[model samples]
Target: MRISPAYLKSGILVSTAGVFGSAFLWLLSFKAMAFWMGPEGVGLFSQLRQMAQAATVGATFGGTNSVVQGLAERKDEATRRQFRATAARLVCLSGFAVVLVIAAAAPLLTQFFLASSAPALVATVRWIALAVLLNVGGTYALAVLNGYRSYPYLALAQIAGPAALVMLLGGAGWWHLPPDPQLLSGAFVLCFGVTCLVGAFGVSRLPKLERALRLGALPKAQSRAFVRFAFSNLVAALSTTVALLLVRSWVIEAKGLAFAGLFDAGWTLTFNYTTLFLTACSAIYLPRLTAAVRPEDRRACMLKTAYLVLGAGILVCHAMVLLKEPLIHLLYSSQFQASGEVLMVLVIAVIFRGVSWVYGTLILATRNSRILVVSDVALNLMLLASTRYALDSFGSLQALSWAFVLPNFLYLVFVVEYACLQNRLMCRRDIWPFLLAGTSPLFYLALSGPQWANSGLVTGLSMVVGLGAAGAALLAYKKVVS
Candidate 1:
């Protein structure tokens, strides 16, 4: 069951393209919405969308992992098909049940969150809730597709959904449609639906992949096992969501939606691109990691994946810090320029995040569900606790960056220690050099302007520093592959 390097490479290419391309479209949509809706609108959109994502996590629980586990183990077409069908039904049903819970609590949620009635915003929240089923359902299916190793099919759905979304949003804009939260959410819902539909088609056809759907039940024991695993996933999802809502509430209360928008934007810039790599890495590695029996194999798998992620991450963050302002203006707007500074500070967290994800995956590979849940919950709390303190103490937007950086570093320590103790793994990180290289650009660019009006000495030093980081990252990547 060892994954071939070629297999991993192919998945990496397709998955990277799909995720990155979709991310680009989403970024475009965010920019357009910012222009049409303003910071308040974008903030509302961000909140509602987060709610949808959080709810999806809860509803599906760890059903996705179960699906992946079931499908990955089942080489028999009939058996895998039946498992897929059964899991699909369970996920949709669970998603619907969760949506009902959200619907009932919607009023309370909006009131508590917004701190005002805000009818239109509440309506938007309700509208976005409808997307939960589609979102979770698609995720379940995608994981199944992923388990089947059908990268092309997964890529198709992944790309088409965003492609369709960009088109939908483009049409809406071309019509000079008055942008409201609902209209914008409708576009998002469309993306979810497209992904679900395409994934359904893709999953239904996988065999080497052409197995027809098996709407019939899987074995009773299998069904029970799926439920049990999914329960752990559900707890993990709920805990993370609670922490997110807590931090988000603090941000909105402390600085208004505008600052929240800046926070979200900066975060997206710093984190999202690496997520593309993480997604590809997980798809290629998870199955192989699960199949690995020896602790040596697991450690090698963990370190190799972590190294790859760190190398990719350092380069990406460095480029982001170097080009923050223009990219912000280009991707978003000048109103979002505050995001550039926030982006610089937050780039530091990418190191911890990338390395931590690798460590966390080791826990996941073992199916040590309790430890995984505990680590996730701990990370979420650490983030919320620190961000709350930062927001409360430092009245400036810059505080949010520290909020991200500090909590992530602490979480990295927790995960690293936990992974080592649990799996006898080592956390060999190469960070300081990358960090030095990544921040060099910001030092020269200055708070006054990114304009080249800075001292000549500082500018040369910054370029040298930035180039050195990029070079180190590239060398690290080469070292890993070699």
Candidate 2:
């Protein structure tokens, strides 16, 4: 059941490159786009992007992720090839239909969001529809590459798409081209198209592409299996998407777009950092977890993976929290300084998310999509209720920030409990490490006092003490885990 060192290393490299490359481009794009378009413009763009992603979740029917999981589980070449062909045909047709619906609905959707705002808002929403359409095709290709475990090609496409878009936009800006929503949307379409083409080339490298491309290559049985696997997952993906949109809309309506903008910025930064690490581990471990023969062995591997990922996540979150003030000051303007507290809350939620992925991926690898679907529904419900209550009571962005933390923590608890009960996770070792790591933040916060004594040196000294405490706690954690 042990993973090959070479494969593990390769997976790490590919995942790291892909995650970091995408993150870099996105961070740069946001900075550049915000500089040109202003905070509200970036906020509008963010809202549009989230809407498109939500639409894509509906349009793709959630088959992409399910396809990868199913294909990873398959051993027979014929079955895999048949599944691929069926998936390809279904995804393409569904994507096209979804695009048509989105286009048709764009006017009404834009009108609703604009709500007596500028005409430019309506135009931006229309362009976002086009971006969403192109994204659907690109996402399918990326899913295919993931299914085949073509990590290098997937990584390459991930890098190329964002890098190209950023370069193009930066060039345009440098040449004094006015930054308009249309230009931004066009950049997205172009990048996505290029990525899709590159992903097609990658898929062609698989052994059975020619056979898969042939009409009627997939038999009825495989098609049935694919549908069975993909349908439930689609529902789960769609529900999650709805939950996100609901939260965003609620924030905008109740609080305001400016507050939502701050939340978005903080959430984006926190999620990218934590997800990059967790995703790297999942990419490497999921296939091995799937290929495991014995329940006990699989349980052991899952526990080890969880420990490693959670440990890493704790370290990263601790560092960020400790340096939150200084980091916020350095990266953002005074308008966004309040985001530091939001960032702290988000970091905690993200740590739980990182840990939950290990258990979630194990469920996925085992074709237990039912568990994922159920968990997602329950968690989303909790998130919606909590978010609503928080906003109603606190009426601050921090309320939204705090709302994210508890649901994720509860979800992680549920996932771990289920895994243990199902005999797919063993070893109580994770509990002690989690408790110790979780308390490190309290120690850091305790030493910060009420104020910095109104001196730059004192502020610097306070930060040093907080970070040092966190470092000591982390080292202690490593020792205990080892």
Candidate 3:
């Protein structure tokens, strides 16, 4: 059952291209939206998007992990069909329930997000709720695809959905549509609808992916287990969403709405690119981990994947940090110039988060729900406390960068240590190379306060170091596979 190096390499390349393609399109759509709406509008859109994402989590009732597990573990075709049928029924029912709840609470959502309950805004919230339903179905489809290791179809759905979204938004602008919440929300609906359709089509094309929907008897025990695992995922996800919401609100109250936009800008640049690597790696990595039975086998897979991610992440982090200002201008606009300062600090956090993500995948594969939930809660609480401390001490939006750095670094440490102890892996010794590569970017930034980004000597040295680390990582990965 060992995964082949050729398969892993090709799978990662295709997955990365697919993720990058979709991310690029989404970024373009955001850029267009930012140009039209400015910082405040961008911040509003971020918040609304966050709300829909949160609702999508609820709508799925946390079944994605369960679905993946059920589909991945079962050897019997009949059992797989029964599991798929039960999951589909649950997903549909839960999606309907969440939509109803959101429809009922539209006014409340408007007040919470917009600070006003105008008729138009409330209607916009309802529209976003419908988008959540589409997204929930899409999420289920993706989990099923993941269970089957259908990475090409996964990539197709990922790329095509966002491609449709970019086109829709581009067309709206060409038609000179108003840059309002309603229009933005409608674009979301279209995006999710297309993704859902593509995912469903992907499932249809794979005869092995077919579910026996007519199978009358539901597997209640398996359904409950899936739900229980999903609830754990839901709690972790909701904590993150709530923390971001609170952080944005506090930034608005302390500085202004525009300041919150700056926070969003920095946050986006730091995490979005990192997520691309993580998601692409997870596409192949998670299934392998799930199928791996021995501790040594799991450790080998985890180490190789971590090296691969860190190698790629180190290069990306340094490049973004060095080019933050110009990238901000190019990706966002001149109005977001100040966001570059925050981006510099946040990229450091990105390295830590990227390293931690490898270990987090281990946790997910092992299904240690308590550890997952507790660690997630701790991360968010630390985020809130650290950001509040930064605001109290520095009293500037730039200080919020500390909030991202400290929490992720600590979370990285926690996960690495726990992963070693829980699995009896050689993490302490083996982690040093990644730790050195991960922390190397912090020195210049800490000393010069983003001024180093402008220094040619610093940039050249960083590029050299980043390339060397990446090259070594790739060699190490090849060694592991061989």
For candidate 2, write residues 447-468 as lDDT tens digits: 3553542245654554454455
Q: Give all TM-scores, in the order shown.
A: 0.88, 0.87, 0.92
- As a whole number from 0 to 100, the lDDT of residue 427 in candidate 2 is 46
| Residue runs of model 1 more than 4 Å from their true location after superposition | 1-7, 208-224, 422-482
Candidate 1, 286: how far from true, in Å? Answer: 1.4
Separate clash counts for every candidate = 5, 0, 1
Candidate number with greatest lDDT: 3
Model 3 Cα lDDT, one tens digit per residue, 278-363? 76666777777887788888888888887877787778777787677788899899999988777777877888888788888777
Candidate 1: residue 434 lDDT (0-100): 59
* Residue 76 error, candidate 3, Å: 2.9
lDDT, candidate 2, at 467: 51
Give lDDT for model 2: 0.68
Name every residue pair that clashes in candidate 1. Answer: 61-234, 62-233, 206-209, 206-210, 207-210
